[model samples]
Target: MSAEKITAEKRTEFGKGAARRIRREHKIPAVVYGHGAEPLHVILPGHATMMALKNHGYNALLELSLDGETHLALTKQVQIDPIKRVIEHVDFVAVVRGEKVTVEVPIIVVGEAKPGTLVVTEASSIQLEAEATHVPEQIEVSVEGAVAGTLITAADLPLPQDVSLLVDPATLIVNVTEQVSAAALEADLEQAEVEAGIEKDAPETEAAADSE
Candidate 1:
């Protein structure tokens, strides 16, 4: 999980107008704060930042070149326009090499379960601790040939080196259950209609009942 190199600029202006100006220039206004240091207001290249986050997800690690020096940071938060769908602002946490950071990585279920068994992922993401530079992009769990009644927990996830699980091992991640057939579903629906005293309307003879 090497950091993506991005060139950033120092931001001297403030306020909504200033932010709009930055966005108009195709850049995003961001702040870097962490490690007991004052927050540094900066501007990041919009396209590069967006692509990096898109490719690596929210836990993307970045190496920012600012003012002839380099700073290592992890993306903490992002704000996007609701209508325009463009990034408005970003917040970064300054980090150092070998420092362990807690992050949530999405669980990717690959392969297929046994036929007639539906695989359901109970947890979409898992919380873990990893080094700043070696954080995993996503955790992959293979469900190939899994039969019904198969349940995978957080402890079953295979982690990479230097990574540790921060979540409880008993946390459910995937559940494989028997799938109901369409015929069975239709029969259940008919039974429910009979139980509720509701009948299908008849052609030309149907009338409003129970009220009218």
Candidate 2:
């Protein structure tokens, strides 16, 4: 992965009002801190930053140009509006080339399991320590021809060179089990409804009332 170049302007104002004003101007409030350096407050172009992050994953390495100086940083956190789903604020951490950083990489299941078997994923993502600039976008687990009772753990995952898993080796990632029949699933749902004291409506009773 390559670092995306984003121009940032130093921010002078602080507070909710200032942040709202910045957003109104189609910018996002951000702070950069790492390497024992003081936090730097800045504003980034909202559309450009969102597009860059969408192209790259959350851990995107960014080349931030501020005051004619460029610094390498990693996206640490992004705050978004829950209702509007708009980017609100972002936190970045300064990192140097070849530095290793621990981050969560999404898990992607590939291939189909054996007939009559169902693949269940226990973990959707895993933690890994990798070079800050070369963090993987996702990890893939193959279930091709996997039979029932087959299990995959973190240690069984194939990783790129220099990348190390930070999760427990025994952690279960995927489990292949016999597929449950539709009738069995329905029976389980009925049992759960009974345990919760939920009663199904009787169509005959409704018909009787209609006749009255």
Candidate 3:
């Protein structure tokens, strides 16, 4: 991953009041911690951080400059307000060169399955261990002309040399199945109703014979 350079200021104050003051000045409160080091609390430029995170996603590497000292950090977690959808707090974890980290990479399907086949994604993302710097933006799964009953498992996907799947080999990621029509759905519903009638009458008939 490429490091996105951003300027940060050390936060001296704490709590709601301090956070509000920082935000009012168009800044965001953030913390960076990793490698057993003490967590560094800092204020980041709201607009710049927002833009970088919006484009690069949660796994982005940010080159944070706090009081002229630069550090490489990963965007670990972001807390957002439920109603307003504004970021409340952010957590960054420091990463060293060649360090491996497990992350959920988004699954993307390329090309269309066979004409009559419907692609069912059993998993939206796959977990993998990759170098911090080489972490892929996303994993692409090709379904080009895949026919019905075709399955794409975790083991079927291609990975970079440094990346390894952490998910089970037997895990089903995608399945191409024949699409069903409305008539088929109606027929199944009718069959289910007939079976339900048989089940519902057996006990009633036995009770009537006992009464006779």
TM-score of each candidate structure, all chains considered together:
0.89, 0.86, 0.87
Ranking by TM-score: 1, 3, 2
Candidate 3 wrongly placed segments (more than 4 Å): 198-212
Provide the global lDDT of candidate 3 against the true structure.
0.88
Q: With candidate 2 superimposed using the best TM-score fit, by how many Å does residue 187's alpha carbon deviate from the native?
A: 5.2
lDDT of 3 by residue, 1-212 (tens): 68889999999999899999988887899999988899999999999998888878758788998777898888879988799787778998888878998788888889998898899999988899999888877889999999999999999997887899998988999999999989998889879988888443458878999889
Quote the positional error of residue 48 for candidate 3 in Å.
1.0
Question: Could you tell me the lDDT of residue 71 within candidate 1?
Answer: 97
TM-score for candidate 2, please give it. Answer: 0.86
lDDT accuracy of residue 193 in candidate 2: 100
lDDT of the candidates, in the order given: 0.93, 0.93, 0.88
Question: Candidate 2 on 54-170: residue-level lDDT in tens?
Answer: 988868888999999998889989999999899999999999999999888889999999999999999999999999889988889999999999999999998988999998999
**How much does each candidate deviate from the true structure in C-alpha RMSD?**
3.2, 3.5, 5.0
Q: lDDT winner between 1 and 3, please give it.
A: 1
lDDT of 1 by residue, 127-184 (tens): 9999999888899999999999999999999999889999899999999999999999
